[model samples]
Target: MTNRTFDEMQPGDRAELRRLITADDLFVFAAASGNSNPMHLTDTDVDGNGTAERIAPGMFMASLISAVLGTQLPGPGTLYRRQTLDFHTRAHAGEEVIVRAEVVSKAEGMVRLRTEVTHADGRQILTGEAEVIAPVEKFDREDVEVPGLVVQRHRHFEALLERARPLPALPTAVVCPNEAKSLGGALLAARESVISPILIGEAEAIRRAADEIGADLGGIEVIDVAGDAAAAELACRLVHDHRAAAVMKGHLHTDDLLKPMLDKAHGLRVGRRFTHVFVMDVPGHPEPLFVTDAAINIAPDLATKMDICQNAIDLALSLGMEPRVGVLSAVETVNPAIQSSIDAALLSKMADRGQIKGGQVEGPLAMDNAVDMGAARTKGLKGSVAGRANILVVPGLDAGNMLAKQLAFISHAEGAGLVLGAKVPVILNSRSDSPMSRLASCAVAAIRHFAGAR
Candidate 1:
């Protein structure tokens, strides 16, 4: 790897560092970097009004600076002297931000410069000045091949879905088996794992649907339920009675399923808030990104958020991440007006003080500053998880849902959902989700089950 010092930087040079702020990116940054600000993106309007608005992390601005300073300005092998910055406002994805730098002075082996990354709206996100030392002459280079990155998932949907195979051997239960698509998804999941299928619903309808979908039902046990209400009850009973290790939802309303699953007596409570998280894989990002509460927990408070954070951290640890969390918000600084920013700071300090463990927490950061080290450097932010974040804790469900859908639909990202903070893994996916996403969700759920059971 080529290390960069700040010497090769020049005046009047400008470049754009390509960063696609997909939902996965936003989710990861929010957890790993701690910048769950309101301005990143909107998930849902509380009144069902319209949309959600979120601010990009100022640390993202700092990350852009590092990108320019190291990759563009100094052209590598440049020495970093010092840098300072201030954020004037917020920025978000779908908006373009440009980083510009000018060489102010050239002295004995030293160059002084000022730089800023701003939104197209002309608002300055971050402004800073720096001193760098670089070689006057350039190093010789030979045109040679560089190794490519090894990928675990990509455009191949089937391969990505089957990455983790031979799922669970325990019998699994499907709740509210009214919707054919939901039953189909569950059936597909069954084929991938050793988990025997126990269909809890209208026996006649379930069988007819299975025939239409061409799914086998020979070994599947079809439990007849009188109606949606009875079906919902039976699904939870299966889990509570130790008939199944996992529960899958079919066609009933989310409330219908949640009611029985969370009945306190028959509920699958793990002594913490139950939440939904979608593991995302964007094209540019190398690994899976987890976006949470997208389908559950509308507006989580700080304590619930702590549970959410722990849940995401637990999934990352399961997926082999040492676990770094970024609490997201509109700005990287604590603002009295915004509870999210204040909470982000408290959580960061909490992580430091051992109140929250299993990861490095930083925030009050925007989205960009969370993932891009270049943005971190330009803004002169030094923290544990500023540039390299492993988990993202979103402020609310609106942010989480919109972020996940945007990446899954608008941008090219894989959405693999799993419900964490439970005694066992839960694959609760949406009908709008792709089959591969459904399969990947099952994979994550099954792997968690297998690993936890051991």
Candidate 2:
């Protein structure tokens, strides 16, 4: 006839038990809850993956506590009627996690209780009210924030790279011979952060290149393909077989590497048009400026252009850019002879009608008009994407490649290029591309990968 104590009648409180989450605990919870959001586990919640170190997924903690409430505490016979949860701050990992329920009132077969799950710092991470029909049942509660890094730091890309932590040691394959230097860059990237490398060229050549580059190839594994062609084929196979998560284009011809990748039967081709992107760092631009179709697709039609736009949008999202795209051309009007101008108009409208996702697009703007508002005004054009464009979709390979090179050579801009829309961010740098540029591309890909970018 006496009312039972909250703990006595229900599951033992984690608060009362006073337990701390270990590395194992974090890993288990992450796997079990599908809350692989790094911010909940890592130190920086800054990148697209860890944007704000968000308060852990409420569903994660609620489910964890509910397991105890249903299976162990109240055990076997409980009916969960209703409950409301309010989340405030973050209950980061490693700290002791607490769950407590205070019985408030019970009448007419209804039980009302105030519940709280607080961090060890005594700050309440989750607090709310719960109600049940006396024969209490298990209940779960779940938020607005996107899980990956979607916001950029108020600083520079170099600074952002400085802030990045080591990658998860995911397998990486480096194309042979000359690309061994790329493997060296990967090594530098790994020496500092994520992207574990598996060199797939001739062992002797890979080591020799690694040694000349002064990279730590001691622990590096050599797959020993006969030549660049074989190495590229092997690299693609590794990715297809799941041996590597990312494929890096090392000292091999882009055409040779892509031949195997695009093979319908035995490669990593996902049946989409293969496109290229160059991540450029300009002194005046706030974030890394990424341009696309620079290295592939001589003159993409509407279909291929769509893929290029989408891929750039994903990369921009990873870079925390709002993805304002400008289809670069000589003029804003869709002149009959100017196919680029027409394509730009179509792409922009496609974006407006929801054909494109996660960004805005406009086209046929002159280079000066696309980048400089004053230039746009002088040309008597007006629109958001007409000026201040972040992702430039050039009309053809000629225009796109030429425009990108001007930004690099003539203006001396800093840029890195990658091929996207693949399973992962593909690192494809030309020999003309400086070592620093190659490293920059790798850093951008790492940031994008950690951010869970496509």
Candidate 3:
């Protein structure tokens, strides 16, 4: 690589680089830049030209000029001052893009370059002009290692929304909409046609919060209620009365929402006990992970864990997956001292007795043995669920909660939560969760709703 100084640069100085625009490239770009307009990346989205091909963003094409200037022409130490761009045509994914830059003039340590980007077919996609301050003196630079980019795919939530798209928007009662994340989630799901939101909370408070967030709630139904508890009661009532198919927690404590549902008289309780599952999409993991008892069951006993395991298995079935339950413990052997290992052994035996259905159950396995085949083989663990478990049944709520949070924050996994074993799926979300999290929960509820009806 050569670094050209202002003294060495001439009128004819030029540089060019070619790169293939791949699907992963487009996906990373869209996610990193937050430019998720479907027309730019979605193949099924209709563009203005009535084409379905994935078109790259105009700025994405123009970025090649900057790359050329920094890495090739005035290579390294080039300071970009200004640039003018014109998009001539849309660049689709898988097309090879060639970027060429020619120095039009150089004066007073500044170089003016004429840049153009064309497809492999020689069709011009973008033309631009850049003014950069050239290095006055060249320095012999050693190769610097650049950090790799970490792209959060959020594909688990995306797939959930896709599954919910075919079904009509389920009418969902959102309790306590005075907060932005919850309200924004409800509105976003409604916009995507995943849920028809029936807002039940303080009307003026909801409107005020909406105004602060610039949410347009026009024509949306709002049922006025005083507090979070009242909102929860009404939301559950709507579900019980067949006025709503699902209930969403909004700006309220988890206990507030669950209290009304556990009433046993007016609640939405089915035959089973209510438990929560965090559907996690972890990068580098082969499949989606079902982490149970994370949100709802705090310190459940053996009987409660049975419900947790069954609920997670039912959820896996709802998502069209073959459930493989791993009874996770600290060690892979039954120890009376470690209650978790004992519970794991019992859970596995219970599955054999038809106490748990529709899932392959394996027990007393460490977390590594459950998910990693190599580790399981090294530990002499052999079973369908031992090495390839999709649903991990933790012994207690604390371990499950920490595992799910670690996957989400440390491993950059996307998590969508649902409380099952009720007549209707209850979407449970954290205040820090994104709108996509809420949408994903709604999608889960929608799938559960429809699947149960069948």
Candidate 4:
């Protein structure tokens, strides 16, 4: 960057910058300015005209002129004396604007500049004039670095919901929805058109739960079952009778919910054993992260681990993501002393030898090199699944459960749990899951059902 000295400046000398205003920019500006007006912060119809507007604050537009004055024209060591601004129109997120500044006049150690901000389509948004103490010394330097900002929002799950909204709502048998949290979650998914839930539990308890949440259960099917195990068994019967496309665990222990589905005579199993996968929407991650066998398959053997990998890979494919499986261990290299590292090596070789299909599998990767590019590079790892793994296959239930919880509590990720390898996807949400998590679980199940049908 080079700056024009006070003596070098002249009338009509101009500088301009084009900036694309983004939603993140608006949020950052709101945080920096401490202005939380709904008109500028929210993307909603403030005036009730119909168009949702995330209007950029007027001062945000004015700051563009400041950026131009400080970096360009009389670029460095510039001090603001006085400024006047006139708002002509509104700027919005996702719009580009041009901020231009022109030297109007010069005085003793001071310069006057005309500034204006206009939309990319030529509509003026803001016009202003500024007087500044221009730099007397000719200043030149490289660009300065600034820290980056990460907006902690769950965009991946939101996108998954959007993708699922177009599909036909999956017919889900919600087992034992006898409490407010579970019943409310199913109803919320129903409202979002992600699921058509058949409430299978005690009729009085179901209605009581509905009343507790102020929900109307009209036009929804409710099956009155007396016991948790009986309700789960009835849900399995519904799947066999072609009444439900999926089963949702609601307000019951996971063992009771899944035990009926494992019956050899009337089970929902197609072939492989059921394995749990947590589809985590971590903030700032480019895609969904899959953590598998978290809720089931405690200390799985090599065969069960293979099933876990295949189940997660299939789910990833159903969600339209090319699966890159990273079988995680304590170290990146196979060691005779470490059983997990040995298992990871075997999993990688098995995938290479066509034992596991539809995904790229690489393993014996520690947590760092599995998901982080810089860490992988530093460790001299080069492969598709080494650094950019979307699916993390852990050694046992303990590691998988801990990893998923760490991402949820520490990293602030939203997780949608699903049990795969059955005839239908099982929505395995917990009592502590937020509404969005439950809804996302339904969306994922619906998406997977439709995708598999195709």
Question: Which whole-number lDDT from 0 to 100 does residue 192 have in model 3?
Answer: 91
Report the C-alpha lDDT of model 2 over 194-250, residue by residue, as the tens digit: 567888877877777777877666776778778777887788778878887777888
What are the lDDT scores of the predictions, listed in order?
0.70, 0.71, 0.87, 0.94
**Candidate 4 lDDT, tens digit per residue, 393-451?**
99999999999999999899999999999999999999999999999999999999999
Off by over 4 Å in 3: 1-22, 28-40, 44-46, 55-150
Q: Point out the worst 10-residue segment of candidate 1 by lDDT.
A: 149-158
The alpha-carbon deviation from the true structure for residue 451 of candidate 3, after best TM-score superposition, in angstroms, is 1.2
**Which 10-residue span in candidate 2 carries the lowest summed lDDT?**
146-155
Winner on lDDT between 2 and 4 is 4
RMSD of each: 17.6, 16.6, 6.7, 2.6
Best by TM-score: 4
TM-score of 2: 0.64
Instruction: Quote each prediction's TM-score.
Output: 0.64, 0.64, 0.74, 0.91
Scored by lDDT, model 2 comes in at 0.71
For candidate 1, what is the lDDT? 0.70
Candidate 1 residue lDDT tens string, 1-454: 2322335444554445545444444555677687766455344453344655544566766767777766556655666888898878766666677787767777788877788877665677788897877656564455535665323334333444444564445466776555568777777767776345688888888888888888778877888887877876776677777787776667777777667666677677778888888788766674566776688899998888878877887777766666778788877778999999988888888778987777778877777777678887777878777866656778899998888888777666878777776655666878777666766776666656766666
Residue 82, candidate 4: C-alpha displacement in angstroms: 3.7
